[model samples]
Target: MRSRGLFSRCALVLGLVFLYVPILSMVIFSFNNSRLVTVWDAAHSPTLKWYVALAANEQILRAAWLSIRIALVASTGAVILGTLAGVALARFGAFRGRLLLAGMTTAPIVMPEVITGLSLLLLFVAMEQLIGWPKGVGAVTITLAHITFCMAYVTVVVQSRLAGMDESLEEAAMDLGARPGRVFFRITLPLILPAIASGWLLAFTLSWDDLVITQFVAGPGSSTLPMVIFSKVRFGVTPDVNALATILVLIVATGIGVSTVWMRYQQRRRERDVLLAAAANL
Candidate 1:
């Protein structure tokens, strides 16, 4: 048992190292004074020059800003559509064509990114040829493509949450002469708020990190952050790229930490509320 435990510990440590060592290296290199990201200059090491350079690089800044805008729009659209679909699937109770609806919502989740991107590319071309709208692929096309796949993730999250939720509260609201819409808005929506928020974050992250689909739909002037990074790294990764990565890693870490604390506080609050209600009843 002791040997097995030691082996398990070693494996866990190795896994963590495998996952985070590259990130650590990137962060460290981001501060290196040398132009070569991998080579550290001992004499004038650990400078913020790369970060300053990253800030001044107009092309990179533009690409990053564009990606952010696309992610925001796609995520918001996805959340709205996904929430409606989730509510329908969870509350409608085996209506006609329910299977079809569910399948369509989930198809993107399972479909290969290459195939999905290719299909969307074909779709945009056909639409443009037919209606002479959209003109050519650009940010608009990328945003639409992102929404298409990102909504699948949101739907899955929201549907799963709704599926596990107790329906007694909704029924109780209805019995109290509340209309379906009022019950949903006042009770169901509040109860499912966490799921909705989670879905939005997940969708945003998917849209932000996407590369393959964005590449397919993006035009000459529509390169996103990932596309820019890929293009630069194909030649050689610079310190400025490392700096950008380090900033992103820090943002992600901060978000995770804040969310963790928030979740713990919410859990404790719920438990305290439950205890208080029980005590009041007694």
Candidate 2:
């Protein structure tokens, strides 16, 4: 058991280092003054010229803004649609082909992202031909494609939360003559709120980070932040890109940190309430 614990700790540390090293390197190099990203003069000290230039880089900044806008909208749509699907799956049973539907829901998780991008592209082309909709691929098409995948992630998260919960509270509410809608809004929704919150965050992050699907669906002049980064990276690297990456990493880290602290606080509050009820019974 001690050996197992030691191995686990070692693996965890290594895993963290592996994931963070590239980001750390990116942050460090973002300040390099050389036009060539290959030269990093540690002894001469780093410079911030790239970042200063980034402030005036209108094209890349516009792409970043567009990406952020699309991510927020798509993630919101995914959360609503996915939450409804999750609730139906969790709260309802005895429907024919339920297992098959659940399988279909999860199949996209393992599907290659490239295939997803290609499939979505084809679907959009077909939709355009059929209804003359999505007139040209830009913000609308990219966001819809993002929503398609983000919903899958949200459903998986919410389903897990629902599976872990006790169904008795909802049963009691229904028994007390509450309407099904009321029972869900009052009891079920609140109980699974944390999971829903987590799902929203997950969906947003996935949408923000996606490249393949966005690349396929994006129209001319509709480059996303990732597309901008890819273009810059091909020229080697720049400290401006590094600075932007670091800022993004910090934003995501801060959001995640705040969420974790909130979850812990809520968990402790629930535990305290449980303890108080137990004591009162005694």
Candidate 3:
């Protein structure tokens, strides 16, 4: 038992190390004074020159901004569409065309990125030829492509959340003279708010981090941050890239920390309210 426990602990530590060592190295080397990301110049070490350079790099800045805008738009669009699809699947049981809708929504999640990207490229080209719309691929096309794939994730998340949620609350609200839409907005929506938020974040991250699909859809001047980083690394990774990565890591860590703390506080408040209600009833 002792040996088994030790082995499990060792495996967990190894897994953590494997996952985080590269990130830690990147963070450390972001502060390195040398142009080479992996090399350390102890004489003039731990400089902020790369961070300054990253800030000044117009191309990187432009790509980052474009990626952020695309991610924001894609995630919002995905949430709206996905929520509708989720509601249909969860509430409107055994409806006509249900199987088709379910299959379409889930296809992207299971399909290879390469195939999806290629298909989308062909679709855009054909659409342009047929309707003379979206004349060429660029930010608009990229955003649309992102929305197409990201929504699958949102739909799955929302459907799962709704499947597990108790219908009693919604039914009770409806029984109290509330309309279907009103019951959803007042009762069902609030209960599934966390799932929706999770879906949004997941979609945003997928859209932001996407490379293969973005490459197929993106035109000149539509380079995202991942595309830019891939282009740079093919030649050689510079210190500025490391600096950019470190800054991104810091932002993600901060956001996660803040959200975790806020969630814990909310949980505690809810527990306290429940206790107070029970005591008052007694």
Candidate 4:
């Protein structure tokens, strides 16, 4: 047992190292003074030249902006649609075509990105020919594709939360002559907000990190950050690429940290309020 435990620990550490070492190297090399990312000069010192140059890289900056816009729109849409779907499934219980609806809601998560991308591409082409609404693929098209896939994740998160929630709160609100909309907005929505927020963040991350689906749906001059990085990486790693990656890492880490702190503060405040209410009752 001891030997097995030691082996398991070693394997876990090795796996983590394999996953994170490259990312750490990339972050470290972002400040490399040399042009070549792989080369380290003993005589030369690290500099912030690449980071400074990254600011002026028009193509990369545009791609980054496009990615952020798509992610924001797609995640917002996914949250709205997914929340509705989740509410229906969890609250409505048995309804017409319930199983089918549930299956369809979750299908995208299990479906391969390649298949989804190809099908969406065909759909866009058909829509263009039939309605001429979206004449060309670009940010709008990418956002739609992202929403299609991301909603599955959001639905799952919201549904799970709803499943475990106490139905009595909603029942009590209804008993008090509150309309369904009032109950939802005042009671249910607040309770499930954390799940919705997490879902939104997950959807945003998926949309931002996506490359395969975006590649199929994107049009001329609509490359995202991932696409730009991929194009640059084909030649070889550059210091600017490293710098861009490091900046992204910092931004993501900071956002996550701030969100965590905010959530904790909110929880503590709520707990304190509950305690105060209890004391007043006593």
Candidate 5:
């Protein structure tokens, strides 16, 4: 038993160390004075050259903006569509082709990214040939590609929440003479709010980090942030890249922490309301 406990403790320590080491290195190197990005110096000696250079580079800023735009739109559409799919599947998905539908939903996750990119590229080509819409690779194309992959993640998230949810809640609302729309809007949607929030965030992050699909779909003046970062990293690491990554890490961490706390507070408030109602009945 002692050995088991020791092993578990060791594993936890190692896991934390493994996770933080790279982040720490990146932060440390962000202040590196050396142009080679291999050496760090005291604050007084360190140079702000990379940051100045990064700010001067309009291409990186443009790419970052494009990436953000694509991620936002894609995740929004994915959440709306994925929520409907999740609701349908959890409540009434046992009909014909349910298994096939689920398989198709998850197919992109396991398939090679290169194939996914190529397939989307081809689909876009076919669409252009047929409809003459979506002219070519650009914001619309990137967003469409992101939505294709983001939907699976959103569906999986919302499906998990729906499966764990109590159907009796909705039934009770209905029994009280609430309309179907009212039951959905007032009861089901409120109950699954956390799940939906998580799904949206997950979808957004996935879209933001996507590379292969974005690479294939991106065109002139439409390079997303990852493509720019990839091009830079291929040549060599730069302090500006480190700074950008660190900024993303901070933003993600802060958003997650704030959301988690907000969700917990809401859950607790609901519990309190329920308890108060029960006490009044008593």
Candidate 6:
């Protein structure tokens, strides 16, 4: 048992190393003073030259902006659509076409990315031919494609949260002469907000990191950050790429940290309010 435990510990450490070592290396190299990313100079100290260069890089800036814009819009849309779907699935149990709706909502999770991308591409083609809408693949197409799959992720998060949620609060509201819509907005929505926020962030990350679907759906002038990174890395590695990656890492980490702290604060505030309310009742 002792030997097995030691082996498990070693395996876990090794897995973490495998996953994070490259990311660590990239972060470290981003500070390298040398022009070449891989080569380190003993004589020269780390400098912010590459970071400065990254700021000046028009292509990278444009791509990053495009990516952020798409992610923000797509995530919002996904969260709205997913929340509606989740509410239907959780609150309206066993309604007509429920099975079909459920299957469609979950299908994107299990489906291959290639298949999803191809189908969306074909869908865009068909839509263009049929209605002459969208004109051609661009930011609109990519955003729609991202929303399609990201909605599935949001749905799963919200559905799981709803499954374990205390429906009593909503029921109590309804019993106290509140309309169903009022109860949902005041009670259900508040309770499930954390899950919705989580789903939104997750959907944003998925959309931001997506390459395969974006590659298929994107047309000229709509290249995202990941697409740009992929193109740069295909030829060879550059220090600018490292600097760009480090910037992205820092941005993502800061967002996550802020969100986590804010969520914890909100949770504590709610708990305090509940305790005060109970004391008042007593």
Candidate 4 weakest ten by summed lDDT = 36-45
The best candidate by TM-score is 3
List runs of model 2 lying over 4 Å from the truth. Answer: 1-5, 42-44, 263-282
lDDT of 6: 0.92
lDDT of candidate 2 over 186-271, digit per residue (tens): 99999999889888888888888899889999999899989888887786656678778877888888987987898899999999
Query: lDDT tens string, model 6, 1-282?
Result: 999999999999999999989998999888888877788865774878888998998998999999999999999999999999999999898999999989999999989889999999999999999999889999999999999999998998999999998888888888899998999899999999989999999999999999998999999999999999899899888888888888878998899899789889999999999999999999
Runs with alpha carbons beyond 4 Å of true place in candidate 5 = 42-47, 260-282
Q: Is candidate 1 or candidate 5 better by lDDT?
A: 1
Each model's lDDT: 0.94, 0.87, 0.94, 0.92, 0.86, 0.92
What digit string (tens of lDDT, one per residue) describes model 1 on residues 221-266?
A: 9999999999998887778999999999999999999999999999
**Model 4 TM-score (2 dp):** 0.91
lDDT of 5 by residue, 40-120 (tens): 566544556667777788999988888888899999999998888788788874788778768877887788899999999
Q: Which regions in candidate 4 have their CA more than 4 angstroms from the true location? A: 1-10, 267-282
Structure candidate 5, residue pairs in collision? none
- lDDT minimum window of 10 residues, candidate 5: 40-49
The Cα error of candidate 3 at residue 19, in Å, is 0.6
TM-score of each: 0.92, 0.89, 0.95, 0.91, 0.90, 0.91
Q: What is the alpha-carbon lDDT for the whole of candidate 5?
A: 0.86
TM-score ranking, best first: 3, 1, 4, 6, 5, 2
> Candidate 2 at 261: error in angstroms?
4.0
Model with the higher TM-score, candidate 3 or 4:
3
| Rank list by lDDT | 3, 1, 4, 6, 2, 5
Candidate 4 lDDT for residue 236:
77
Q: What C-alpha lDDT, on a 0 to 100 scale, does residue 79 get in candidate 5?
A: 95
Q: Cα deviation of 145 in candidate 4 (Å)?
A: 1.0
> Listing every candidate in turn, what is its Cα RMSD in Å to the true structure after a full C-alpha superposition?
2.2, 2.8, 1.5, 2.2, 2.5, 2.4
